[model samples]
Target: MNNLIIETLSWGKLEVTEEQIYYFSKGIPGFDEETELALIEMAESPFWYLQSIKNEGLSFLLGDPFIFYPSYEFELPDNEAEELQIGSNVVVRCIITLKEQVEQSTINLLAPIVLNPDGNVGKQIVLHRSPYHTKHCLLQEQPAIDGKDGG
Candidate 1:
């Protein structure tokens, strides 16, 4: 119980110190009770998945929405910003949609779970925008791979 152990692809039993774990207040939708989460690299994938040790079976795929959608941007309502203490030190991230094919994947840019990595505080704020969807398809075009072909 000394360190937060998260299973990862590259680093086995990804040990995250208590100081490194972030607390998601209000948790993800339909999972409000799951407060604590540890972010670890998705084994052999470009995404980072949040693991809820308390729930065991609960976990979500997360990533920098901007990584895929460089133009991706959103505003957290005043209430959410105040609740999360999203000061200048916080970082914003979104959950990516899981697809059978990697190219068909999409990130939830409309609702991002902003986190204050330094303070271990977080909240998922929804963006009431029509241009973006909760399930936007990723990679509209086939991205060129320099070395390995698969994503």
Candidate 2:
């Protein structure tokens, strides 16, 4: 059932689908009131735009943290997992905050958005005592090359 919804975003107007809509029962930390969000794919990129259907101005740039941080792992508490009806095949994504320089972009590892692909239910869960931080730089500074080593 692909129900088209016309929305005006920062980039311009877009037509989203029903399957693309995600419902967050408890809502995200900052945007608690805005529960309905549309997961729009970014053209030619792995990133996705989680736009709020309730508010045109609210949207977030999301990314699959596992793509960049292969070793990244977080345990979902039973309570949260049960609430979202998520099983082992859940999709986990983190919010990406871009800086002036693209290389300086950071992902919010402390909190991750977990979704049940089958049910289309999603929730942003904040880890209670995780080692991850909100600003883990995506790009590492390049090492200086020696001018004498011409070989």
Please report the TM-score between candidate 1 and the true structure.
0.78
List the global CA lDDT of all models: 0.75, 0.85
C-alpha RMSD of candidate 2: 4.2
Winning model by TM-score = 2
Weakest ten-residue segment in model 2 by summed lDDT? 139-148
How many Å off is the CA of 101 in candidate 1?
Answer: 1.6
The residue pairs that clash in candidate 1, if any, are: none
Q: Number of clashing residue pairs in every model?
A: 0, 0
Clash pairs for candidate 2:
none
| Candidate 1 whole-model C-alpha lDDT, 0 to 1 | 0.75
